[model samples]
Target: MNTIPEIATRLASLCNEFKFVEAYIELYADNAVSIDPNNKNEPITGLHNLIEYEKRFLSNVEIHDIKVSEAIFAGSYFSLVFSMNFTVIGQGSKMVEEICVYKVENGKIVSQQFFIG
Candidate 1:
């Protein structure tokens, strides 16, 4: 059986693969929040809201060769580094790295912050 931490990793991987708002929202709590640098107009909220957000940004983005640099698990929170090559809608593909801090409660993510470079 997979541990909770492992499950969390799988969830993260799935999110990276789809990059759809609904995919992430489903992994979070009903009232979850996500901090995104690219989307400065608003902070993502709720599963439905996240789906809409994904539709805007991830509609044509493609992720490849995801490398999990690290995964730190706390009692109810986790931090992760995901390095990947990605292509935007009209831009060429490039190598990018992102670190994210996530707060999970009752098996659902409650808050998340993304750091991309």
Candidate 2:
């Protein structure tokens, strides 16, 4: 993607298709930081860390459905809302509404944060 808006649009599309690993590997900078709701001790920094984090999160979960809301873009930042249903291995299926915010710099995602309420 040539611009941040394009990247955001594609990122949301990848997420809707459940391409979590590909999304982070392709769109995130080498030193990007990702803050997930699962662990908040410190932000997961670097592309490798983000990829591993996503991999671990997706490893045993059964993805039931994903609905991606239209993204809201402001400057080089954007937010996407996801309604997801999944079964977390030992845990039963659950539905969650999460908002993911991304900050794009140099055409790569420099930082991302997730919020679920």
Candidate 3:
């Protein structure tokens, strides 16, 4: 069994902290999807767009009090809850929690989806 910690830590470090493009790209497949509740038009695809979209969001962003929960590792699928305090431009800071499910293969995420409320 592969440790979910490896993937989780990388994701947290890349997305929540450094916004490392290379690490971010390494996590997803060529055709990955991200569904965002805050944004109406989502499920964005492709690695380049994913990195660019993340860069666009994290350009002047701040996150705190991040917690991951409900992590279930079932072979090729991993699901977890990511909760954090986020501050974005134009939109004030708020504490939000989203459920993210990742489909993994060969230690890399092939597809990812987010369900937020």
Candidate 4:
């Protein structure tokens, strides 16, 4: 079972490499929940649903760069600052910065919530 720090490290590495789905599949629990403020502020429950949501988003954007900060941990939770530069298909380029917080239980990430900045 991976510790919080270990999971955080792997998540950051995978995200930096643009392996978002891979990270999710490897680190998240089956019934994981994802809350994205930009997505109507509704929680997307289940790993399958979360992955589908991510895929939809990815299909609509051309990611230019991604920067993930070192994780800050407190008990079973950890947070990271993610800055992404991307272009929406047929739209325009934009940069977004967000604080991503994750909750880990029994070696798997059970929930993630993002705060856009």
User: Across residues 1-117, which tens digit of lDDT does each residue of candidate 4 receive?
Assistant: 499999999999999999999999999999999989978889999999999999999999999999999999999999999999999999999999999999999999999999999
Highest TM-score, which number? Answer: 4
lDDT of 1 by residue, 1-117 (tens): 135486477666676565446446457778888888877736788867766766777567777677665478887778878787778868889897888888877777788888987
Best by lDDT: 4
Candidate 2 residue spans exceeding 4 A from truth: none
Q: Candidate 2 lDDT, tens digit per residue, 1-117?
A: 859778978988998899989998789899998788789637988899888888888997999999988889888899999999999999899999989898988999999888996
Against the reference, the lDDT scores of all candidates come to: 0.72, 0.88, 0.71, 0.96
* Model 3: CA > 4 A from native: 1-5, 12-22
lDDT of 1: 0.72
Model 2, residue 56: displacement in angstroms?
Answer: 0.6
For candidate 3, write residues 68-102 as lDDT tens digits.
Answer: 66467777777878787878767788888788888
Is candidate 1 or 4 superior in lDDT? 4
For each predicted model, how many residue pairs clash, with residues at least 3 apart or on different chains? 0, 0, 0, 0
Residue-pair clash count for candidate 3: 0
Question: Ten residues in a row with the worst lDDT in model 1?
Answer: 17-26
Q: For candidate 2, what is the total of clashing residue pairs?
A: 0
**Better structure of 2 and 4 per TM-score:** 4
Ranking of all candidate structures by their lDDT, best first: 4, 2, 1, 3
Question: Could you tell me how far off, in angstroms, the CA of residue 58 lies in candidate 2 after the best superposition?
Answer: 0.7
